[model samples]
Target: MTEILLIIPPFCYGDLSEAGPVYPSMGIVCVAATLEHAGYKVKIIDMFAEGYEESKLKSCLEDPELKIVGVSSVSATFKISLNILKYAKEKRPDTTTIIGGPHITILPDETMKETYIDYGVLGEGDNTAVELADLIIKNKGSPENIKGLCFRKDRTLIKTEKRQFIENLDELPFPAYHLLPMDKYRSYGVYDSGRKTTSMITSRGCPFKCIYCCSSELFGGRWRPMSAEKTIEFIKKLYDEYGIRHIYFQDDEFTVSHERAMKICDWIIDKKIGLTWECLTRVSHVDNELLSKMAKAGCKSILYGIETGYEEGLKQIKKGITLEQAKNAVRLTKKNGMIAKVSFILGFPWESKEEINKTIDFAIKLDADYSFFTILCPFPTTEVYEQIAKEGLFVPEFNMEMYSAMPAADSLIRTKYLTSEEIVQMMGHAYKRLYFRPKYLLKRMLSLRHFSELKRNFKAGLSVLRFTVKSMGKKAKLAKTT
Candidate 1:
């Protein structure tokens, strides 16, 4: 029986994504680590990895010593998260229910209206989580003094002062990975080497203003990063303790600090940790020299968000990279013996069919080892979402279930010029043309070494075929209607 319980609600994508796309909830784990360092007992239940067994969940809720229940969620998964919190509130009305993450951080007032949620931590919850847990433990002190918190006062919503970002990330303890079901977590789609794999975040936030991105809102507009020494130490621990060979950095922009990245790579080489890693970053932040150093440090892959190929779409999104820059970045990544994984979006509300086609052609010309074609989703709290909502471009009764950029046929925001059906067809066509080529198939086959690699690749290939066939069927009906 612990004083606090941290829960991640199980979710289903409903044709949008795999039924259970499990990964460690780094947010909650970091909070748990803070609580542990502060001398508090904490328990975590990752419903996403554990399959959300009702009996097991009920057993966790039955702990008579439980004082606080914390739930973390993103924008799309907030509804499921709310439902789970509501259930917990019903079971133990006396226990305090707290919610945090991207959703609540973006719309604190709206989220606080949910009575089941007794409190919410606005952003970067490590410190605020400890504050809340301390309050519950002491059973004293008003929440009004706690910064970055939202709670009820006399049946009215009250928000506190904004919390400052942690300047030195080294001050925080390593994430409580021991509390997670490490064996059950897997992130496979488009991840070529997915055995004994886990994800890490070396830094937070981005300075660029890409309209479709919500990184700035979630991590604050400023870019704060952990020191190179701390990041390398964290990597060594993961490799030595968890036997994790492949690490995927989920930072908004890993290469934002070129000097820091270079130092980290050099340290990885000096220590000979023997772990291959991948990162996602803007094409503009990297150069040939950086790629060379990263390759020397066992960087096998680099994912670039080349959002669009057409200049007009690029301008609209403020991607800050020209077509030439993107091409050079991919070229450098491959030249340095790393796999270049590129991503593109098919539907911007202001984009035309001709422009979308040009973007698709550009992806083929780039000929990356892996490509992800997402239908542009105007997620809430994004520049694109605000623009689309103002222009009434979103589909009538648009639901969050289709908010995923994956699910080639799920289009919730359709431009006034193009119907939602057309966007879906275009997304499906992009994936089929990008992945089903003879050269692409041969390239992927040559890279395969183990059964796990073959299984993940085959599953991804089959997924592409299914999305294509479904969209093709929808296209015939759409053509008849026109």
Candidate 2:
């Protein structure tokens, strides 16, 4: 019997397919750990990992001992998440429902309007979750005093004082990986090594002010990271117990502190853990020495968010890095024998067709091992979202359901010189220009050192081909309509 059930509502951005990647939510599991450490009976339902079934969810809600149902969500999954919680309230009228995540944190007032949701936990929910559980279990205190909590009182929304971000990350317990379907997610991301793979976040928050990102809103704008010792200990546990061989560091920027990152790498090397890892960071955060250290310590890939190639585009989005910096970072990453994966975003509201195409041209010139060209998705609470709203840039057909970075999908907003169809067409142009080149294909073929690389590359190639075909179909349909 579970006292509290934490759920991740099932969702896929483009379509549900067997080929889609599935992984556990680190946010929910971390909150679960805090609740368990506080002595509450907890269980996790990762409907995303194990496909969503209403019957299965109903059975969990039917538990007599289950008092609270907490659902986690992002903007893409928010609708389904609320539906799951509403179903919970319908099936078990006595149970309380709470919603939390970046989506709810950013738009608490709008989200709390849902009568099915009993409470909302804002940013960094670990401590607030435990407090809510303790309050519910003991049945004494008014939730009025609980920081980082939102509720309705007499039909007026009441959001308590914001909770402070956890300063000492080392004091927090490791995420409840035991409760997750770890094996289901093995070898799951794009940067896998054909070994048992899982994701980890040793830090939170980012200092950069990228307009399309809400990391600051979600993590309180402060970079908080666990000590190197703590990170290694967690890695060791995952290595020994779960036999995880590859880890994807899901930090907003893993190399925020160059020294801490190096120390963690050194510990991994000296301890001979032999675990391959990859991380996503900004182009400005790395240097030659750090790149060399990372490669020597079994780092196989480094993904940089080089969002646009135009110098003026960088300033417009507050990317805080230059084209030269991006080039040097990718160069050094490849120099140190690691895959240099870079990403670019198209469809900025101010960009003309020429400007967008120039960005794609810059991506090919960068000569990274992998290039991810995506249509810009202006998620709520992001500066880009606000700018679009203020400047009347959003397309009349902008739908939250279609808010995704996938190039195959129609863009949510349009630029001054392009429509939604044109943005997607540009995305197809970017993908084809960067991926189908003879030189790029030959380089990838020559770099294959392991069978795992071959398998992963094949899947990636097929996926790109499918998206390109879909984009062409859309283009043809648009031309006929015109």
Candidate 3:
């Protein structure tokens, strides 16, 4: 059996974004299970859990007989993956290196331009990865036969035909959670109370066409779901085996099928699985009745992407949810005694100062337990990215390092209506308006019905303050350079 190393790079935000304690890397676990099922010796090194530095990562790659290395990358961690790949190639010149995940899936050809990465996997990677491993084990380097793969041959890039999306999500095995360093992962809500927290995915893909979102493109526009019974069974297993009291559904849209969601909720309730969970949901898919049921079924929170408050800005992004609907959803969630986390984005090209103010005002009025605001980033392979590229709106000199932290004054894109500084200033103002209110603080303080909730909120607030001060300092430094 060949020794294959699957490395998940460190958490790239580095205290910039709220790190949310640490959890097992689901990507590596899924890939490991697929390879192990094929009789391969697989090992996963989750650097985020171990707090491994660059030197440590380099030392780990010193294994002389390692045959293959697979890395997973996201938007914020793409540069980290590149660095890891570069180091791995230098350390083991003969080892086959592969990169996959959202970043590479969206830009396969561009990713293949790097000599360090020998192959890039697109779309769902479990099957593609197993096939690639078998091919590598057989001493075959030809990538043309593999679907959803891009490689180089004789100094030219070659992309194979795209593969169809996986329709039967249930066919996939449960992630190889037992193979991970489980003790390293600690959740604020769990660790502080000596409880346990776990993360799981109930399904994949989103049906929405939000212009700024790439989930629909990455996981096909149609939603593929797991059986409710199977999902509940997994939840029960996590609770029984790992002593997990909290779970996060890490899905793009948890309520894609309301009927399935209700069925799952019923099963969880019927089984008396005493696990609290959170999930991301669309504003349009939620209702008072459904929210009530969810709260009863142990759902503690739901995160909503209310991109903008102005109708025009929402229309430009094709978010498909009205301002009224967003407000109603928040109210319903609160009415049902569950926490509502509202997510907003600022500095869209189509947004003016007036439009951004609308967002701030709406956020202040909605009064969710927590709010998150991010600058609009035009990621590669999205419609928004193409529009920005065509209009020459993107900063041509921007590199992946610039994405590590939140966009500073100098890093924000200049729009026709707002300068980069103006956008950055508006983001600061949005945070102040949404979070620095007496009512907001009071609501947050009073909402902590349990000691676990109180501790989680306190830690999260501290993290936010630390991030804000650091971001402000960085912005000031960037301003001086400019």
Candidate 4:
């Protein structure tokens, strides 16, 4: 057995993965398990952990004892990953530099053309990474026929056939949480209302074809999920080992299979592990019965993608859900004693100021426990990106650098009726209007059951206040930076 180091690069707001700074990369952990199963020494360096330094990154790459190094990043952090690859190639020319994650999966050919990136693993990396390590790095054999991989051969880029999706997700090992900084995620305020928090993805892909979403682009529309048995076993391990009381299910569409979700809830109740959880799913996939069962199973919160208010906008974006469905889902979640949090986006290419206002009004009327608003980021490999590129509306300077969905003054694409400045202001206004609603404040204050709950609420309010001020200030300067 030889050494290999897996890296998660830091990006906007110091986040390294989509689960935020608090959660380790399930993808990276899966790959690590594959290597470890093959009797390889592996170490994972998630840079979001507090005590990480830049010097350590260079040293990790420079270590000759390491046989191969894999790095993963999303669309927003592709440049950061590329820079790290360049440094790795410069320091240890012999070490293999493999890039994975959402970025290269969507644009493998272009990404592999970069001289520094030795290989790009598309989609799920567990099987592909293991195959690559066994053949290319460990055995020193041929790289051809290694499915779901892209690399340059004899100065020409080559991508193998796509690998089949993992059919039996239960066969995969539990995420290598021991290789991660468990205490660091807890200290970072990652959970909703639990003492210790972690995340789990029971499924591999999304079934929907939402145009603005990258789920289909990266993982495809095949929704392969672990069985209810696996789901229970996973959470039980996290609870007994890491003291994870609140597990956020980061599945793209958790309730897509209604029966499976109900069974999962039943299993949770059967186990009585005292582990409260939260989940994100589409609005239409849930109903009153499911919501009631979820609450009974200790679900504390639910999130829906209420992307727009009007049916026309929904049609344009292919959200596949009517505004009524969204409203009912939120109402049911609240009625069932679960926190109903929803998210909305601003600066759609076809959205005008009036349409945007309608969306904001709808969110306030729904009165969910929490709401998130962000400027539209037309990321790569999406219908929104395709439309903007076809119209030549994307600003040349911003490109991939501005793919972050944070409220920033600069937009990567120009909308029909709003400038970059107006979009940013509208984002801030959305936050202010939603958070400052008298109804919202009264509901939240009443919902606080304990003195410490009130104190946490106050601190959260202060945090939002500071963010609002900073977002407004950014609206006035840096017209082209994130």
Location of the lowest summed lDDT over 10 successive residues in candidate 4: 12-21
- Listed in order, each prediction's TM-score against the native is 0.93, 0.93, 0.91, 0.90
Best by lDDT: 2
List of clashing residue pairs for candidate 4: none
Show model 4 residue runs off by greater than 4 Å.
14-21, 58-64, 186-194, 404-409, 449-463, 470-482
Candidate 2 structure quality by residue, lDDT tens digits, 254-304: 999999999999988898877899889999999999999999899988889
80-124 per-residue lDDT for model 3 (tens digits):
788888888988888999998888887776677789999999988
lDDT of 3 at 24: 74
In order, candidate lDDTs are 0.81, 0.84, 0.77, 0.77
lDDT by residue (tens digit), candidate 1, 1-482: 68888998776543435412357778888899999999888999898787777787678889999988889988666777888889889999999999998878877877888888999999889999888887888855669988999998899899899998888888999989888888877755444345577778878889888999887877777788999889988998998898888788888799999999999999888888777888898888999999999999988888899989888788999998899888999999999999898889878888766777889889999887777787887767899999999999888977554442334547787886678888887776777777788888898898887787787677667766877778766652433211
Worst 10-residue lDDT window for candidate 1 reads 473-482
Model 4, range 344-396, lDDT digits (tens) per residue? Answer: 88889987778888888888888888887767877678889889888777766
User: Candidate 1, which segments miss by more than 4 Å at Cα?
Assistant: 11-22, 187-195, 399-409, 475-482
Candidates sorted by lDDT, descending order?
2, 1, 4, 3
Is 1 or 4 the stronger prediction by TM-score?
1
Give me the displacement of residue 85 in model 3, in angstroms.
Answer: 1.4
Location of the lowest summed lDDT over 10 successive residues in candidate 2: 473-482
Predict model 1's lDDT versus the native: 0.81
* Candidate 3: residue 82 Cα off by (Å): 1.3
Which is superior by TM-score, 2 or 3?
2
Q: Is candidate 1 or candidate 2 better by TM-score?
A: 2
Give the clashing residue pairs of candidate 1, or none. Answer: none
